[model samples]
Target: MSHFSGIWIPIITPFDGGAIDHGALHGLVRQYVEAGVSGFVALGTTGEPAALNEQEQGAVLDTILSAAAGLPVVAGVGGNHVESVLERISLLNHKPIAGILVAAPYYVRPAQVGIVDYFKAVADQSRVPVILYDIPARTGVHLELDTLLELAGHERIVAVKDCGGSLDKSLSLILDGRLQVLCGEDLDMFGALCAGAHGAISASAHLMPERFVAMAKALEEGRLSTARQLWHSLVPIVHAAFAEPNPGPIKAALSQCGRIRNELRAPMTAASDDLAARWTLILNKVVGSPAGLEQS
Candidate 1:
């Protein structure tokens, strides 16, 4: 089966004047592709899928797929409603996507058994493979190791985006060698890669995708020193991206580079003046360098 195993950028949906900015979105996708990222994840958490209406979400994904230029794109399929989520997956199955990234049911925090059942059912109906998204911080429930092991038995349940925040669980999954373990925690990406993770589904990679790709390559080639150097430099930028609830800081940094307008939907405003200022310097240091990545 095809498995994802490199730096994948979960793109933030760029907005302008309360509408999806297709022009900017396409530009962002083309930029990342040229930067040598392994793949792309559209409508993921960082994309602010929650803020987008159903039609808008479909349009955004369509734009991303078109702009990706045949690169692998994983569509995020997640929701608390099982029937609705299944229907969504069914529709997505017809799309020319690499896989579907599904998170555990959020807010409801279903029991472990229910979690397993939910994934199995989704996997059963999905025409494409499934990349389990285990981000408990947003989902409010852990897809515990046991549950994952059970799901790993399924043919279509191929890989995982490990963001549950349990080091022990992460190590166990990596050691199991059944499911391809892709780190979802940006800050822990270097460590996870060192521990044999397949790759990362990184939001921060949206900034300097080549650096993230180079770091993954370094680790794969057993160039620990080189990977460590890249990781150290990326630490601050990753931290800054999350300083104000996600895409805000990311958009702010992108705006400074004239990539996007740094706008977000209601209830999710742009980054603070202070955080935007801080990201400017951080991005400047990371953007153009002898290390990796070109300034666009």
Candidate 2:
């Protein structure tokens, strides 16, 4: 079975008074596991990994793995330096993780060839499967179709978190049939899944995850009506989740439900009051009284 196939939450790192909230983080993993999410992407972009020091990141991953009980967990490995990323991957290879999510070198904006080489080197060094995170909006470089195709040939480079923002390229990757394509964009998930994407690594799945899982399962089982209904119900929450910058709106919604405190690292503030109020209204309408967000 493909490890990447299903709704996986790129979980947010909850904080309490500026400290790593391991208790809340553990609670989240248990909550999602009960929600039936396929797995998790610990320390992914949504987790505010950049704000976490190495020690904090390691501790966060440890809490997630322990709380996940046996579900697969993919650790996020991101950096502009190849050697540093490789070193991190080397360490993660020892952990009981399912795979590593690596993005293109950010800030430097390396050429496609350099991008190809960087991934190849990382894939070679890693013992676990690598999921290419092609989020160009954050990284400032697109993982072009040809470059993606070339990387698909790597045995260890197994899948892609498709955030490249090109439908044609995304569709092409699906058709190629080499690398499993997992939709990274929350809004495009339904279309991508209908077009044959294996699953999604969704940040918004942090809230009301069971619906997301059900939606994915419905589509996979050829129940279009069921999937469409869930998608329509989910659209408002999805839109609101990203209304502000990520993790903020998401954390706010989670906080209101008492899942975690509505706190974020410096430079990444909590969702605005207007957005949070909108989230409450939408949650009430969509899921009925924020019951889904209540502690498990």
* Each candidate: RMSD: 2.0, 1.1
What TM-score would every model get versus the actual structure? 0.96, 0.98
lDDT of 1 at 278: 88
Q: Give the TM-score of candidate 1.
A: 0.96
**Candidate 1, superposed: residue stretches over 4 Å from native:** 288-296
- Indicate the worst ten consecutive residues by lDDT in candidate 1: 287-296
Kindly list the per-residue Cα lDDT of model 1 for residues 155-204, writing each as its tens digit: 99889999989999999999999899999989999999999999999988
Considering only N, C-alpha and C atoms within 3 Å, which residue pairs clash in candidate 1? none
Full-model lDDT for every candidate: 0.89, 0.92
- Quote the positional error of residue 55 for candidate 1 in Å: 1.1
